[model samples]
Target: MTATTTTLRVGTRGSALALAQSGQVADWLSSTVGVPAELVRVRTEGDVDRGPLATIGGTGVFVTGVRARLLSGEVDVVVHSLKDLPTAAADGIALAAVPRREDPADVLCARDGLTLAELPDGARVGTGSPRRAAQLRAARPDLDVRAVRGNVDTRLGMVADGTLDAVVLAAAGLARIGREDAVTERFTEDVMLPAPGQGALAVECRLADRHTGPYASALARLDDPVSRAEVRAERSLLGALEAGCSAPVGARAHSDGVRLTLTGLVIAPDGRRQVRGEISGRAADAALLGRRLAQRLFDDGAAALLGDLPLRAAAAAGGG
Candidate 1:
């Protein structure tokens, strides 16, 4: 019997940060499975369009093309920032592993040195994320929140060049590419719980490939069980709320030995109404934690605030 020689194809975006992240996985594969590797770059619609993300839709816009490559056998595996993936898995697609998370908090970079507390009345704050925009508005109702969309450097440039007073971004992404010093202060969970799966990375492969199994298992070595449970709980909360990724929902889950605690927040667009909650349960019962928290919030009239928007517009926009 002859063994088939294999060099796994890893698909990723062409951006500097995307390549760096994919490189981390490829390096891990080579060391663990002793297999040669190659990177297949794909251009996502998100990359081609310099328009506002709101116009293009949110979440998965950066991932769909690479996911297609995975399904088509063009690439054996794909790398993604976990937040870019929806809580619901697509048909024929599954996530094999979620690596240990990076920092899961939004950061404020202010040129005027105004902290979230110090921003003057009617101050202009910039952010591409509805999650951040809503939360910032909820936190400081006095300031003016506006939309600004682009990659990290582009958004940061708004602050650097004095186009905006300050902007919010994921702390993990900044740290990933050596931009940590740009973070003025990391928002506390009460102020800005991160989006579901914000700081994690998901490496995916086809369901039953024997060769890729070894490499996938190698990547799974980096998975943090506690982070996995916490992120899973947070994703479940978002899913139950039926909130689009653009919805102003932020959450964090943590575990202490046998108990898992989930904290959730929902804020209105104008920053006037904010609802927050926390529930503790057995670490093994993530779904229960999410369900109970959502139910309690619903009893508190969360559903009244969440109107059923056109699902068609949402799906077309992106399952964000």
Candidate 2:
């Protein structure tokens, strides 16, 4: 198989972390397939606005621009954090690859080196995601959770300055930018289930849009088949729930040799109650595993908890 040596544009959001992740993708593509790939920085509406994310459109404001560039042929490939990709696929585009996954759980970045348990009552924990915020409240109902927004660096700075006692961040985002030191503690699966597809990368490309065909295929060699299956199941759960990306839902999927297991949760905003369910099935029926989990939860009263969210949850928090 021949590799493409000509220039290939890879579009990515222009955040420090986004660029770093994109650079890693470019490095993998170039070294694995002999394609000369460069990162094309794109400014997204999410990056420009400092307002509340929920008030603005919640359709992953970060990845839309990059996807547009890919659709227009301005870039041959676009790499995005899997959590940022919508459950709905775009027309003319395919999620060609999912290149493994990192720690999918949220991490706590606290001041004075305190863990979630060591923190005092009424201590402020900052987060923008409803799932994290609801989980924080559930874990420590006495603590205060403020909605926070910004790039990873900006949010971490709040803890550094003592404005916030702690913050919840995606472990993968911390790892991508060499900011693992920012984490005071990694939330365990039992305590805080991650957002669906939280730690993987989605490689999007047009259907049969090959740049030096065989080389393109080889570069995609980085995709991990098992991780792809896990994310598919988790995303299917999200789709079945009809919850937007901002909804207070948490899901995780794991596969052993014999079966795939999916655990899902829907939390009320006040943290007093939540609905949880799990399902196991043949690995080949991962999507069914997710749907089954959803059906069980709904039958068990998840709909009442998530229905009319305001009665179930609080108003959105913070401006970034």
Candidate 3:
């Protein structure tokens, strides 16, 4: 299809970060494929509800609306924050591309420039993610970990207004929103392993569109082999674990084009118990490496550690 014959409609959530990420993709599509691309803002249930994420649903909440639009032919393509996407595959849709990733580390956006360790006892740390909360408690048992939910600016506003001493957020989100300077410190991987597919964007299209659609060539240009391999390994681990976004699980994968290494962590919600493991293999065996590492973690008592959490069950059911 020629540029004048097709206008690629890219659907995205109507959030600042989502717009920023989708805008970048739209521009790339237009320039690279010589096709006119436009952004279609889709409001998700997650965006309308202000309750805790786990209570409303899990990560899939942000994706359902947009995916429906893609499947219904309202949009030709969609962009998603990789971390917000469930590990399970959706029928009728395909992940066509994963562009180069940004830094996947979680960062401390603390007031008064206080690092996690330097914060006073009982410091109020705001985060809605179970993984971040568990890590915070594990590192500083004295902290007052509070459940807070909002967009990036709203979360930052709490700290700016003295309602929260600090807030834990993805370094990638902050950087994408041009607020990286607000980060007090980017936590080391040992301190806080990032979520599966964090710091990446998932560009998806209808399964039927991947090979013969007008947007196929443009989407193909966005795929980064290294990022795709690394995120695939991490997400494969998550899928094997049968854990959802609400589970206190952390994973990060790295690839040097030839070899890939994946680290997986599962921590008790109360931060009392944790299991960690790592596996390395040829980059071509990324998915296998992730599954193997997950099995190792289960052998290390990850199942028992997570068995009692109702949130895990809720996430699984919601994803279905």
* Best prediction by TM-score: 3
- 1-320 per-residue lDDT for model 2 (tens digits): 46666776889998888898888888888777666788999988788887766666553777788889988989888988887776666778778778878889899999988999999989999999888888888989999899999889999999989899999999999999999998899999889999999999888887666443444575458788788889888988877776666778899999763578899999887877899988888878888888888899899988887786541222122111
Residue-level error in angstroms, candidate 1, position 80? 1.1
Q: Name the regions of candidate 1 deviating beyond 4 angstroms.
A: 1-5, 50-55, 210-214, 308-318
In the range 1-320, model 3's lDDT, one tens digit per residue, is: 45546787999999999999999999998887777889999999999988877777787899999999999999999999998887778899999999999999999999999999899999999999999999999999999999998889999999999999999999999998899989998999899889898899999999998988887877887899999999999989888888887678999998999999899999987787899999999999999999999999999999998787666665555471
With candidate 1 superimposed using the best TM-score fit, by how many Å does residue 263's alpha carbon deviate from the native?
0.8
Instruction: Per model, state how many residue pairs clash.
Output: 1, 0, 0
Score candidate 2 by lDDT: 0.82
Cα TM-score per model: 0.90, 0.93, 0.97
Note the Cα lDDT for every prediction shown: 0.77, 0.82, 0.90
Question: In candidate 1, what are the lDDT values of residues 1-320, reduced to their tens digit?
Answer: 12226886889998877888888887777666777789899999888986765556666688888999988989878999887876667766667767778888889987756688887788788987777887887788777788876778888888888788888888888888888888777899878888878888888887765235545566567666777788778878877887766667788888763789999877666667777889999888987798789787777777755553333246433476
**Candidate 1 similarity to native, TM-score:** 0.90
Best by lDDT: 3
Selected candidate, larger TM-score, 2 vs 3: 3
Stretches of candidate 3 above 4 Å error?
Answer: 314-320
